[model samples]
Target: MSHLTLIEQSPDPEESKRDGQRHSIADRLRSMGQVRAGAFLLLGATLAALAWANFAHGSYDGFWDTHLTLSVGDLQLDFTLHALVNDALMAIFFFSVGLEVRREFTIGELTTWSRAVVPVVAALAGLTLPALLFVLVSAGSGYEQAWGIVISTDTAFLVGALALIGPKAPGRLRVFLLALAVVDDIGALSIIAIVYTDNFNPAPLLIAAVGLTAVYFTRYLQSARGLVYGSLAVVVWLAFLASGVHPTLAGVAIALLVPVYRPERREVEHALELARTFRQSPSSEYARAAANSLRESISINERLQSSTAPYIAYVVLPLFALANAGVQLNAEILASAARSQVTWGIIVGLVVGKMVGVFGSTALMRLLRVGEFGPGLTLDRLAGGGALSGIGFTISLFIVALAIDDEAVQNEARVGVLIASIIAFLLGAVIFRISDRLHPSEEIGRTLLRPVDPTRDHIFGPVDAPFTLVEYGDFQCGFCLKATGSVEEVHRELGGRLRYVWRHAPLTRFHPNALAAAEAAEAAGRQGKFFEFERSLFSDQEHQLPSHIIRRAQELGLDIERFERDLRSPAVAARVRDDMLDAEAMDITAVPTFFVNGKRHTGPYDAQSLIRALEQSAQEPQPGSSA
Candidate 1:
């Protein structure tokens, strides 16, 4: 049988040009239509909400306080227009927040310890100090529930404002402001999950756990359907809502549990090669024909990473904002809020607290020898960014609704939010202006990592030989999936002599499921069905893996009970950690990194060269042998 080897596509001008063209089309569409549509929807929603609240109150007696009920026999939910927005619509907002939080941690800025610490610490201080300030002024008041209102920062509003200034603002300032806003969002979500939740309920809590477990396994089994995930997410949200945890947490929970990898890059290339060769060959073959069946699989694999931002940024986030960002303030309410301690506290906390907290924390970190400034950033610039971090509109509003129930108190908090946002904006602008004048320009440095090597090609040996190979791959990487088949072929051909050790080296800046998948595989390995579980990791439709892999083990007559036990065990997670550390130490930047007979080869390999390398190794004399 002629062996098939896979070669991962190195980035070429042709592919880059194609990608750039597609991006241009996407950008044009977004600018010409989506942006305008989104803006109109936002403005319309805001106006509708305001009109609904104020018109009902003014036009009719007791309209704002009128009790609205949704009942199914004995089941009833009773609330006002405000409560409906706060408790129900706001839950979706929080869910979106949760998704953003989960994304940041899993694949964005919060993924690495070093890269994560700066923003996290800044966010922590931004949340903590403002909350402390609010409590200091309003500890025994009716507005104590509104503590989280000051801890948020609105990236969209701030960025939009910056865009209005156009070329007058430096690009570096924009990047800095955006970073601060993203970190502020992280802080805001953490506060919601930790500070807002009431005491937990046992039954609903269990239900939430079960739903989460189901999502995790669904991704593992690779039989994930989007509707199923969406349905389960609803269940999880309802459970959390009933359990006294905010329902929004469920969105993030679902996002985290969704699988993201499309097998290894090697496997895709191998399949493609087999398909191409089989099409050219005259002989009838079963495996070759089966391989040829997956010809369109490569294109499908590319779509995996491309789907994340479009869904989250444009769809989920806008819907959430439309649902949550509305409040009506009549003259009386505004006058009352101006004098209310709750309102004043929120205003002060946001305007003063966030700036002081972020700037102080950054300064403290530098003084304590914890971290140095990032390239293209300085203390002055960071301080200016901190001032802007006080624009805590979206999350702050969500938290305020959760915190205070009284009309007077809510109005007071809203006023505080408005004033604080204005103050923060002006102050941030001033700081930025001063910093720009003081320091005109800065050179941006490259992020720490070497470019991928192109010289080495041989990675895996003969598929039918008895040889053990191990791979460390990132799920977000296209190349890693391309390398999958060579490892599989080695396992198939070598059998017992070839044991592939799978490890997690997820680059959190990209793939959310990489670490989880690695952990899941390790968890399954404990039950001696590692290969089966690994296959499901690739074949399953979900972003992660199915929760039913253990169930499959049960059907295979393995110890299903033991497998379930191991899935939750810390050892599995620990093994994944060890692999992550190994990757870090080896300076392996790209995914699908290989180790064969103590030799390291990065990227995917073709079959012919792999066979040649293995044959040569086999024939070479040992150091101790007399030839």
Candidate 2:
């Protein structure tokens, strides 16, 4: 049989079909989590609220203001319909936010101090400037404490706005705005916990702390039962509620305590082995063993995030908008709000303040050499993104409800939020349109692979192989580590037909140990053990440490003194730096970026995908050849 036929026949038909079905389900779930779907849901809910409030004012008011009460024997909890949505239902929304924040800190863009500095500093500036502007505009207006309304960015609306702007918007711009908004939410949450609480009660606070401690300890258990966690979460939320702290904070605390690491590499290998056995024997017992092992390979943190995100986006947030975005636009209320300082304060704070704060601070950072914008993000695009940040709707409404007691002031603030959101969206859309005309999409045109040098880089397989695969990767990146298995599989299948090259693209800002790891790999290459060192590094997490590097070097039977000397040599560091420079020139923003036959490969990096690409390349004429 041909190579393709042989590869296709390697896996059992039933197992492949099952795997395909599972992947289809995952893809559908991910599609539902897109920005457009969430945005449309939120918009639909807001429009429904507006129609209900304006067309049937009395019924709307009476229905939302209806009291809801829950009791367990002597203990009772009471809240109005609107308050129930804000205080109780919104906890789920905050829980999703907490999970996202934890992910960002652990593995996403904000994983390191340097990677975080740009967005964190920008968010701080974004918050401070808006609050200052609000205070200045509302001075002597008896609404100074409502400055919290101006400090948050509505991530849903902002993301939606970007989506509306279309694919002309660079991916890096989206990432930048996301990091900034998450950081902004963290700041806003801190303010809510510290500045808005009404009373202090130590007894309930102690109980909440105890609950959090219990939740934290659950991470160490081999199997954390959901029922146990749910009970503890309730205790924490109730304690915080009675202690005068916002109960939503309990969500954040619980999220931080969840473990985020996957099972060991050996365990993953064993799971694969079990899966193979089940595929061959087709027994229920083996299937169950393989299923459990596969489940354990993924982290609970990721599982929770994937499972809960769709609900929070589609249900919780839309419900919040329906309950709170209903501001009656009657002539009398409009006339009053138009003349109110609170309205102007919020408008100016959101529109003008956000623009100056985000763009200005970003510019200042570049000038000071403290931080720089990511690839494909220009100053004009940044300015437009800043304008979009001003579209603060959800969190601003949430805070206005908490901060303002006077019905008149609350109405004024709500009107400001609605009007300002419109103006900001228009302004941002115009700027992005202008940016699109000025700097059209250039990613595809600019992504070409540099010619490989055998003397400077590590290579595997035959040098004259018809297909070449170059990976620009960071050793510390989890995705890159995972890609190693796929790389090995391609090499094994292709044999002498493929040449595989490795280049260092260590994201030093995000991965602090990546630079050292790169140097060690290069040092081992000098001792004719580069592929061995690379395998050792990817197979275990311990290779990230210096002592582990030494141990690995000894195991590989390298010249100890020469290896140590080369690890610190300027030449080794230079080679790594050169690869990074090439990556930057190509705007390779993420790790495990692959190039197939001198063209960037943008699809999935699974073994199947790589093999297909190689097969296609083999059928094509070689570069610079006349067939």
| Per-model lDDT | 0.57, 0.78
Worst 10 residues of 1 by lDDT: 443-452
Across residues 1-627, which tens digit of lDDT does each residue of candidate 1 receive? 000111223334245325433543444345435334543444455456456556664432244346799897987768775455455555554544445555455444445565457676887888889989998888777567678788788765565445432122233345445545666766666777787777867678898999999877664343335566668777787788788877666665665555432233334445656666776774579455645445334322123324443453455445444444435677888788777889889888988898999889878887886742432346776777788778776677677767787756776776688678778878878886787576443211111111111121112233333443546665445656656666566556555554344555664544545565665566556655565666666654244523344444555566756655555444554455444544443434445555553345332354444444444545543221110
CA lDDT for candidate 2: 0.78
RMSD of each: 13.9, 10.5
Please list the residue runs of candidate 2 whose C-alpha ends up more than 4 Å from where it truly belongs after superposition. 1-33, 166-169, 281-288, 442-444, 447-627
- Model 1, backbone clash pairs (residues 3+ apart or across chains), number: 37
Clashes of each: 37, 0
